[model samples]
Target chain A: MNYLFDLNAFLPGVIAGVAGLIALLIDSYKNDHDGIYGLTVVSLIAALGLSIIDMFGPVGEAWSGMITYGGVSAFGNTVVLLGALFCVLISREYLKAIEHEFGEVYAMVLIATSGMLALASANNLIMIFVGLETMSICLYVLAGLIKEHKIGAEAALKYFLLGAFSTGFLLYGMALLYGATGSLSIPEIAQNASSNLLFIAGAGLLLVGFFFKVSAVPFHMWTPDVYQGTPTTLTAYMATASKSATFVALILIVSKMLPAETAEWSEVLEVIAIITMILGNIIALVQDNIKRMLAYSSIAHAGYLLVGLAAGTPEGYSAVLFYLLAYTIMNVGAFGIVAYYERQQGLDFTDVNNYAGLGFKRPIMGVMLSIFLFSLAGIPPLVGFFGKYLVFAAAINADMIALAVIGVLASAASVYYYLRPMVYMYFREPHKDVPFVQAGITFKGTLIVLTILTIYFGVAFGGLHDLLASYYSGDWVTHLTGN
Target chain B: MISIDWYLALSAILFCIGIVGVLIRKNAIVIFMCVELMLNAVNLSLVSFSSHYGNVDGQILVFFSLAIAAAEAVVGLAIIIAIFRNNFSVDITQINLLRW
Candidate 1:
């Protein structure tokens, strides 16, 4: 247990944190939004590049086993950084349109991204708690970015109250786990994993906390409100990046900390996945608000990811990683388009009926939104379809045929809701003459990049899937599980 | 000497009370306090566990949790105040402008 200062292992998070502080200092002194924004984007891109490089580097624990770097953690960091980059890229135009382009927003986003980075690689319960709270507190403020808007205020309050409440459960669970295992480190907990009452109770509470963060069913009441009320671009950030980071942490817990001999936890996950899928899709079917609908859709996507977790195999875990990357790209694109429309009229522009004839009005955005929605619906030749395919394939391979069948059916049901906006955009006549909203070159460029990635990854998902799967195979498995 | 079980039991009871308060309370401030209580309860348990194990990790975790709770309270109160200024009320039941 040599406590070496492994700067390389923590560099991505360090870059973002230092950049956030600099952004904050700049904001306090000068109030320069553009400079702050540029700084944020450059720092995030550098962090993303470093994380990608780390994925191919040697897998090891660092900071005296409080953090793990390379392999899966690096992949998680890359996904989170990618989500943050896209959100920040598109946020400038949207925030300016809303007349609230504060430099502080950029600082908060960077800080939150750094917290997510910490969470992704967190090997200790203390790191997880601190990382999760840092991210949540910033998000609470971001949710209420417009304090004057009643809905925004309401969203922040609800998010804060619920988020804090969940933190209590999470902390208590961590305490119990520490007591049961006599250690706060994840690998140590795994080595001492047991099916005792305290251990099971702690695991259940931890699951509740993760489920709330991920917005799974029953714990999902906060999603629609928070997503709808938050500024659209930051909503995209919250929905994709934060969820990816938490899911990565949950994956670590499920794979490492839980006793493999117990079928109880898997059964519990299967049930939650079933309910999250059915309810999320069914409720989304009737939503008129595009942001709210995407909220429910995100919940449904979480269910599909949970299906992979329930499969309880290395294949299932890697499938989850692949699905997360695919999910991040398509979701940010979907929400990015929503932000585009949202900033145009400011409030009430997000309703699906308002999208009528919008396809013809702005053909490029219309086409890009279509690509993202289709990908989300798991259509062929898009990354989302491959993501769904890999997850269900992993489930089937693990002999969870019932779970796979239910997942396929739920996703098939999801296609209807995902296509609702497209139907209104292309097929229906415009009830009101809404003018086309002009988007900046960078905003359009980001969407275009996302669209190409969606299609390109769909067609060539094999290589990425193999790469992710390799992270969970052979020596990497022993390294990750600390065997 | 009080066994560690006594501390764990007391902590569990306090946590349950806090959860109940959060679930039933309407005033946003009270709910926030209830959350703080829940956190304090966890802190108690962590401290007891640290002493029981004769290691500093659990105590260190308690410190982090305490710092996090204070940060959370600051944000939560600011949010509650912001919502109050808009709606002129801190009652959770009345803050329903974005319902499903």
Candidate 2:
């Protein structure tokens, strides 16, 4: 192991951390909290630029293989930063509307991004736990930022309780794995994978933690309440950026670090994926609240991504990557629209009937949201269709035909609930005579860009897919751990 | 010297107690304490394994877990306090503004 620190390898995380502190410093003096927003966005863009640049550069392990930041990690970092960027852009209107423009929100988000970068780049189980905790702690605070709002505080409390409990599971799993394999480095653990019952139980327990983070079935009870109770902008970040980071960590571990254990675990994951898909979509059908409905749909989407993980192949890895990109774009856009049209700031504007005549009132917002929902439902000519296609295709290619069939049916069932809001928007009469808020340029611009990307990526994602499919120099499987 | 099995078995027992407490305890603060217990149980196992194998890595992990667990407790208590400010109680059942 080298004694020197690889400063360049850790630059992205450094940028976010320093920027978060700087924002907090600026927030202290600026009584009104206006300056911090600009500072936060600038830092996020800078981090995004660094991540993209790193993607094109050379790749290798850093800090004695504690971290690796090239290839998929680079791509994941860029996606997370971009998600943060969009959330920040949409949040300005929300905080202003609610008169809750606390500058600490931006600082907290930057810290969260820093944590995410650490998580995506982790090579050891200990590193993964630390990164996960840092990010989770920040999000617990962000969920209840509106301190006076009971719903926000409750969301924070519930999320904290569930999150801490899961962390306990995660830690115990790590302990068992360490006892069985005698190491915390994932590659070392992989190298020592045996059919011993201890090893299998340790791996199973480890997955229990990741599943909770991804909000898979049997571990997703807190998602709806947290999503509905938290402010919409924060909910957008939690649903998209947070979810993507975990998927990246999960894919890296399951596919790269622990492929030897695939046979034992993939079947188990397949069964779990089937259950998560069926439960998520079926429950969503009855939800009247927009945030809660999207929360359930997000669980189904996690199931689809898990299908790729259960395949345990390089193609499965790439498919999960592409799916996360599509999921981030569409999910963030959907939540952004919800944040945009919310009538009351603290209260969730969730009745299905509230969307009535929305298409006629604001065609741009309605059409944009419709396209996002369509993309989510696996409708073609949208990136979300390709997201589902690549995953189920990978599952089929891996000879899990039963899992593929279940995925298709669950997605088909999902389309019904996805279109319910559109039906109310274009066909029915609104129940409330609510006054309209003027649409601003930034709001329209964010929607138009997301809509364009959804279609553009749908047709043009093959190149990106191939890029993700290409195994890289820094990949733990390819060259690291003295393998 | 105590055998490692004793430590592992004790850790497992304590871990189960923590899980059951979290499931049954209604007060948020007590639930937080249960989470701490679970974490400490893991720490005990980690420390036992580290000593048995003569490996410092497991000991280092125990240290990190201890620190992070403290940080988590801080955040959890803060959130619980925030909720208490609103409703004067931290009973999990009392905080259901956005239930299914």
Candidate 3:
């Protein structure tokens, strides 16, 4: 509550806000659009630089309670910054194609990234809700930003309604927990494990709210529609950055408050994981549109992450983090290629049939997408395989044999759908009229970097895991859960 | 004088009403109203707890939540306007863009 100025804690947000305001001004002028875009990108890079410094460099311990910067928060921040960069990398081309380019888009994205940074470091419930709303409000507008498209409008509205509903649930749960325990701080709630009926009710409702936020089954009905309706670039942003942040918040909640008492929640979560995996993979099999297919694929991946979570161990938690990191690379690359083609084709959905003979026409885009698909299917020596492997291994180690078995079956079933587009792309006759468009330099450069990272992580798992293990060994629960 | 249990029971009933509204109402706006109701129910309980513990932290939180709820409502309405333009109706049942 002190009004003392520490420029460090407030600097990133201020920079992002100023950059966003400048972008809005430039867009209003309707000139120097490229300059505006450049400014936005530079702002995000600056923020990314600060986050890395906070992670690796020694920031004074003054703001530890407000915004801690140890290994786990640093890891989450690094992934989120990567997402922002990917958005910035794709912005010049994607925004240019829509012909209504504005700097506000990039600015808002960076600001949201900052909010997520705070959310990850939130030591209390109040900061968490503030962070959640700041992030969500920007996204609602971003989702519906394409004014000309009815689909965009529909997606935005649906997302807003459902997101607000979930927020309500989340807030109510927080309040009830406060009521039951007479505390609102997460550390306080975690330690005071009163088994009163009110406490149990609050916990139960809070689980539902978190499940909705992560888009777990029984509460995930909104994901596919929203994903399909939003712009492809925005969809990629949601699939990677937003999902990563939410899961980080979710894992913190579960581990900090419900570790020893996991038996109360694990039973319900196990059922959710099983249904989410099966339904997501099965529905994806019938999708002809590549984006929609990826939407379902992301859902199935969520279920796989849940399998790690259900195990409730450090190995399980780190395994989820590793998998999310891998998913970010593969999914972003996949969507990047789609965004590339949409620009060239003068605005068209990337359907599976359209990709037939694409391998011959646009070898680079086609091959990159194939790698992403294979990885998603959990093929060996790909990033996706290791992500799923870690989660499954964690599951077995936790002795959740049946859940691990079902997870494997779900991944196997996923192969059929993930590979379907590859079949159309590589094996079938080429579609002659729609030649693959030459990607702009920025787009191509980003794709190459993403592809390399995807493969490198897939192959060199031991080192990355070891580094992550050493860096991320401290458990928030031991301190929070003990009275 | 109303006992603490009375306040708790009243909050529970309000929460249940919100749940029923979400399950039964087809109008997106109405469903949103129900969500607000649920949040209020939680706030009522929080206020009661603040009194019980003789601390104002929980009460201060209720204010913060109220601000957030107001913002959420504004955004929700804006989105509904966009959707109403797209579908020409506010009925959730009619907005099924995802059909197998």
Output the TM-score of candidate 3: 0.92
In Å, residue A126's CA in model 2 sits off its true spot by 1.3
- Model 3: per-residue lDDT, tens digit, A189-255? 8778677776777777777776776778888888887888777887888788877877777776777
Q: Name the best candidate (by TM-score).
A: 1
lDDT of 2 at A477: 53
List, residue by residue over A30-112, the lDDT tens digit for candidate 1. 97888999999999999999999999998889988889999999999999999999999999999999998899899999999
What fraction of correct interface contacts does each candidate retain? 0.94, 0.79, 0.62
lDDT of 2 by residue, A31-145 (tens): 5466788888888889999998987766778988888878888988888888888888888878788787788899999998898988988889988998898899999988888
- Native contact fraction (fnat) of model 2: 0.79
The local distance difference test score of each candidate is: 0.92, 0.87, 0.78
Give, for candidate 2 chain B, the lowest lDDT window spanning 10 residues: B91-100
Better of 1 and 3 by DockQ: 1
Error of 2 at A83 (Å): 1.0
The DockQ assigned to candidate 1 is 0.92
